[model samples]
Target: MPDPIYVPVLKARQAELAALSEIQPATRKAILPVLEIAPSEVDDPQVVSDAVDRISKKLEVWGGNELIVDAGFLSAGIRLPSGQGATMYATAKARSLGIGAIPVARLSDGDSARADVRNLQVEYDCGVAVRLSMEDMDEDPEELDSSITALLGDVSVRRDQADLILDLASVQGDIAVRGGSRIVLDVLRELEKVEQWRRVIVTSGAFPVDLSSVVPWVQSEFQRYDAALWDAIRGRRRLPRIPIYGDYSVAFPLLVSGPPFAPAPQLRYTLGDRWLFLKGRKNDPRGSEQFYEVCEQVAMHSEFAGAALGTADARIASPREHGPGNGSTWRKIGTVHHLDFVVGRITTLGEP
Candidate 1:
């Protein structure tokens, strides 16, 4: 597969997958998503297995397509994880399905993880994506090179075909955004000292994890610093290379644990480089009814992409179709719109 114009680092949640299902086929070609599988979502092997099964089936549609799949969340909480592990169960449990799932191997991953990544690289005949986080980048550039070179060797991937990813996840404040841009240039400076990579992706997320600070019933606007950070890097003069732009869409970079804390009906509408965050009171008796008004507001807004834009836009435009859905539904709506909007934005990038 050729290099993608956008790389959306997404959590493998139901809402995220649902949004992916709604994206137009032509739009899907613009993004190569890095799917993260969290093992802590469920404890029971059966349930986790079922979720992984569903994930595989959802991804099977993109068979013969390129996608980076990381079961690295397994590094934290072990359970039935990995698209590699999921699809391994595919042939024995169900009929065979083909998917060009490029495995990811981290510097801290164990021997088993390396083996799994290597097996996948060989099976698909594609190289792996090495995602270096702030923790990994904390080391000096020389040490950074050492760890990354060792990781690529462990996965047995040639540098020319490997994807070097700089994951600066969750740069929430202005200070962090500036720091993020600096990191991007620093990594680029280091890459100039190394061999060529098939693709160099910079991923980060600035979406606040919760809407706790916003006043209830107030529609607040927040900057998409993640986008701003990328723009700053692209606008910088004398850059080594223009790496691929990536972010977590509407989701935060750091994964939160426990049950979702969606206390009220909230709407996240992507308008240009900012999010129109609208929220209802917490613990309101009318569950999700606030979404109707929220949808109405979005539908009436000039930035609204109209009902025909995508499934989520259609839902936001038509409040009568079904009950105002819950938080997950809103996430799906927000993400679909974000994906649709950003795909076009990146196509005609004016940041530089």
Candidate 2:
């Protein structure tokens, strides 16, 4: 039996599926922070409470939008050291806050993936929602397609009553590259052939790349790739019906319904400061200077005119040496700094 609370949500989704064709393209900006909580803190009630509060505050800033709690980062098997999963705790907390939660499933093998789905069905029984992140998709395209088909078939047969959200981050590829766009389009084309799973939510658009490695001349080309891919999707007449979500990294909405826009000013300012700080720490200032020059090129690009330098901040903590060296082990103490950004938000036409 399904949880009584989840039955209504499922019913609402079913109704929406029927009316997908008539839906309108509505755009809204939102921030989705994917929280990474350590396992040591998971067992502590107070620690978990504090972490949940912090996440809740972020959601509140976004006007209480649905929270996407990723379970993949927890551990390989989706279980903590205690056997109980962090995903369960996060989902429960989100529900208690009267906000919907989407848990991402990240299993290693096909058998484990199917088993995880069944377990979620039996455990939650109500409000069961799970997302299959594209990053977990098998490298072989045929195998991936078959796996997805089989997973959906199992869901339909078991009546698991789980809402499946497909995170397309991995599929969309890096915006700076051309092949990624083509791959995403191919995947979408293949999925379109499967009629039963047409209603699943699709997260479209690519995550932003680190500006440190990008060429100044190719900045405009990156924006062009993103624009062309989106235009192709729209030309296929699959906007409101298919439902696509945009990434906060690019600051572009789900669909290209209007002219291009820039990321928030604050995002730009913070990223610039982060880049300068990283450059200051580097032994070769020339590399950092070139990186900034490319950023300027991106800002001046016609497609991204008025856009801010949307670079990401990254850091690595470890000693320079490990293992035995000479008579005794020698270690150089320091941290390495790199730049990387995470995509924010999974904007959907309706609540996931």
Candidate 3:
């Protein structure tokens, strides 16, 4: 494929990793993933070191050819125990595993982190990604130009060799959708004249922080407002380039959805414009075993895509046979199912 059909900005956790590792090869070829490496638990004293150690272990088995490694979730200026920065450590570990991972740099990053980017470009001659947040887009086009220049600083990687990412982060409500798209147009104005970008990707998530508003033991639907925001930009706004679509894949960017051991089982199945949510019986004594019942409901749905879709689908279709899996197992199941659904949409819907 000349260009990937989709970009999934996934958290580098066991659930997401397991999902990526299990997707069919054909589906895998269609995506360029942006793996957001998570930092260590806050309770840990050596978070910086722990972050490095964990990411190193994660990449050793990542098993992907191309990815955008974003350590934006890690502590900004903190140096690894090895005297390197987060991105530097991640890309190096990826290289050792023969993975063609591109390191990401942000305009708002600390001096040491930016310096790591320069070293990657100058010494390694490798590709780097420049990610700008929604606040960065708030700048006037001229001011945005200056920010990009300042971020590139000393060794100055060529813009044509770089991927420019405009991240909206999270969008909600109808008003937010409209406001977010406007910001996108503002940041993109006259940007092409500034430089020829290798690729432009816009990523955001709309999955709610929790399911408190949803009624337990009932099936409900929620809008994927992030996808709607991208549509608003693609159709309503006139821009120089069509950004590659990316999202958090059923998870929000900044918030945890709920406690891992919640009484009710949760099921999130993705469709194009909305998600089908099935919350288990809250007061049931079965607790997590309720997942089997919920999973069975999703599997039997008309849009389930059947067991042939992926590992998750198989487990979903035969929950008892697979065992009453925990939250992590269900996360992997839902995420893998989402991967199949999104890729299927891209291929069938044909450039939305």
Candidate 4:
């Protein structure tokens, strides 16, 4: 049977409306980090933890679900309820204390500043940045070498603990491709799974989602997830380019600050142990052209702390290769331009 001439247009409009409809309810609501504005005198850990407990209880009463009571925000740039100042603490201390807030509002009041906040959240949430953190090496040169090695060891430790910490931060991990298989294709597949995973992340409260059902890569037998997620993604837009090569660009993925505030977690954590999935292609220097493009995309949009692609002569940070998925079995290995992308720099929430 022949379909109506307007069917395609109608279908497109329906998809647009569906995306918009998904936004309206929480569009105007501002989810801020519920914080404890403390006086400088109360820098004690026990004191802060107690205050965090109080704040958490209050937030629950006010319909808030998440809290980040970290000392980092004290020295970092965080606006207190007004006129209150304090010092930042270690993660142990920060975890003891509560930070962040969740404001349950019904609609946007059209305030320009609030609108700006929304924009910032969108930008920072997904924008990648070079993130730097100092670690104690050794006191002497001999010890310093070992110290640097020890510091690098922490990167692994942090990676291992990413899920737990990032979960508390309200961020999800993007699956990065690695290993001896068709790495690029594997990354694309993981990305598809990631997009599907995002629906579960943002709309989990409104809808139940099960990633395992949609993503063949995941094989857990006991994890129960919403099946409708696959349908939602299938109904959404698909990137025309799968093994997107050439001058293609993509939005730098971001990690959310925590639950009830951010959309998803950072790509680093999202990729997790799968970091080694891609095999590096050292023989072809031109092979890194695509990765360099990805790095440039991140640089244009993010505030990186110590990006390494600054030098063309640098070794491949995480080399990997792809094969067999698409036509032609080409072996190309390259490094992931080394850099630490900081997530949750987004100041505003709930905007396109």
Candidate 5:
């Protein structure tokens, strides 16, 4: 028998897990394909509007579902250095097309509009469902908690009302991948301490590692921690379901690409390590073609396809890959021409 005090928490977690199992399939169906526009594409008002129009049509062809437009690209536009202008534009455009648009904001990216309490207020007022990135704050749990609490306090909204995203790719350390699990668990624990914001989402970079590695590690950690907590309360050891309600998505950098069918190589390279090598046909410029192939492979292995792909048009601002094993020179990579292929693959994987 379990201690009466902790029995409620354990039962609640069990019920939540059971509910998740039933809705997992529908959750996959509601996945919002993300389209990242380049800074260059936002230079002209007409150009930005036209790009949004094209994206709307693409979403329709892809099954008329909602889309997630990364607002990071608006930072490059001449009229909208803050990126907010582009965000508003994308939101309005999606509404005009009779589809939903969710704008994602990275609070840490200097190029992205700073997500202060005031900005969040405006977002809330505009009826915009914004995704706030917490990658920069993962290193310090206390500070992360304060910032999140402050933000949520200002809005007075529940966790599910705010689309908070934790990017595991941004965690830094000697063994960053391994360390990422600890960082995520710590953050989740901190959030639970305050209030159980079960709807928080996780995302990962496409290169140097796969999101699959990070997601499973997180799930396992939650289960282990929950079990230990319950055992302490009940005076007996027993497994317990995870109590939180968050899920993870994958994001592929536009500049990074590889063969579609190739398995994700074990990503052992350290962050900031650069390298030059070819994984596909020699001289074949790596771009979106390879990205779609990789996303397809990832979806096939995971329980469901990712919630969204980080397609923001941005350069690999920092080094994410290591040099070739033999120590070779580096070269610049390019972008993918056909985002349609990427969307198609995601749609196929979302099917039953």
Candidate 6:
């Protein structure tokens, strides 16, 4: 069948909004450390002003310390900031705060530890918490994505789980296979222990995927990604950032009378930093009130850099009166996560 007819007005509006240049909320100015006037300096207005000027310059010299990196165990007593939305807000803001600290606590090693970190961030509505230091994306693109992809493999599959001894690994167009006689053996092993696997039900924006190479059994997965990517790319100027190493799960919360659809919560998992962005629906006239509360809570807590709790603009299309689910209609909600908001080149692979 021929492709469906395309419209441009709404798509154009969406593209405009998506590409509309706006200052990121968490910027250098927001993170400048406030200088307290010392008694000596305060006695002289000029001294106080000089101190303030010095502090400002120092902060600038820090080059936007929005993300901080540190190692070694920190006290569990390090409590999150109080207030409802503080954690969420702080985490989102933390990124721009440049506070990308990586604590080297013994408890943060290996898969179990990593899983705990991911889960903690998700539960707390922390936007994009990462156990690892931010990786350099400017390096070779192929090498960077490949390293991340491998790291993700280790994170997802535990040693206690089925042993997947991939004798050969390759990214051919769209087909991914760990060849060798153990390939089938690994699948069987994993199936036997499937109960231990975490079942992630993805309910967020779609991403792009090449369809030609996906195995028939997993074609549905590819289709879902296709829909999401296609929806996002409409009237698109630049490519929408796709999931390179993360798992996203969404939950729909019931709403009172604002809209017919429920507000959905989205959880995004990434390698460098992990955070969960949640967007829920509210009935108040100025619906942003509750979200702001949550954002404030995240901000005060050191555990999260900050969070982005706001109305989500992405949507999944619904079925028409006599048509299949369009997969484009979006319900309003808030989202938070720690994955880098960057796009990469589309990859294609062919099956051998």
What TM-score against the true fold does each predicted structure earn? 0.89, 0.45, 0.91, 0.19, 0.46, 0.20
Query: Any idea how many clashes model 1 has?
Result: 0
Q: In model 3, what is the error at residue 174, expressed in angstroms?
A: 2.5
Candidate 5: lDDT over CA atoms?
Answer: 0.35
Instruction: Estimate candidate 5's RMSD in Å.
Output: 14.7
Give candidate 1 regions above 4 Å deviation.
Answer: 41-48, 76-96, 192-195, 282-285, 350-352
C-alpha-based local distance difference test score of model 1: 0.75
The digit string of per-residue lDDT tens for model 2 on 199-262 reads 3444433323443454323321233233234344445533333424323222221222333332
Q: Write the per-residue lDDT of candidate 6 for residues 1-352, one digit (tens) a residue.
A: 1110110010111111132112133322222111112222123334433433333333333333322111112222222233212122223333333443111112224444344334424553222212221122223445533543454343443323211111121122212211211222232232233233222111122222222232221112212231232232232333222112111211111111232233322212211122233333335453433344333333333433222311121111111222111112121121112111211111111000
Higher lDDT: candidate 3 or 6? Answer: 3
Clashes of each: 0, 0, 0, 46, 6, 62
Q: How far does residue 343 in candidate 5 sit from its true spot (Å)?
A: 14
lDDT for predicted candidate 4 compared with the true structure: 0.21
The lDDT of model 2 is 0.34
Which regions of candidate 6 deviate over 4 angstroms? 1-246, 249-281, 306-336, 341-352
Candidate number with the higher TM-score (2 or 3): 3
Model 1 error, position 176 (Å): 1.7
Tell me the alpha-carbon RMSD of every candidate: 3.2, 14.7, 2.4, 23.5, 14.7, 21.9
lDDT tens digits by residue: candidate 1, 154-264: 878888878888899987778888888887887788754444888888899878887788997777888888888888888777788888889898988887877657657
- Please identify model 5 stretches exceeding 4 Å from their true place: 1-30, 62-66, 76-84, 108-135, 152-157, 170-174, 192-198, 206-352
Tens digits of per-residue lDDT, candidate 5, 1-352, equal: 1101101000111212222222223332444344455444236766766665555454443233354456565544333333446655655566566555455544333322333323543553322223445446444666766665555554444454455555443322335544544545555565544343423444433233343444311121111122222122223223121322111111123333354343322111111122111222223365323433323332333332233322111112212333221101111111110121222332453211
Which residue window of length 10 is worst by lDDT in model 2?
327-336
lDDT of each: 0.75, 0.34, 0.78, 0.21, 0.35, 0.24
Which candidate leads the pack in TM-score?
A: 3
Q: Which residue pairs of candidate 1 clash?
A: none
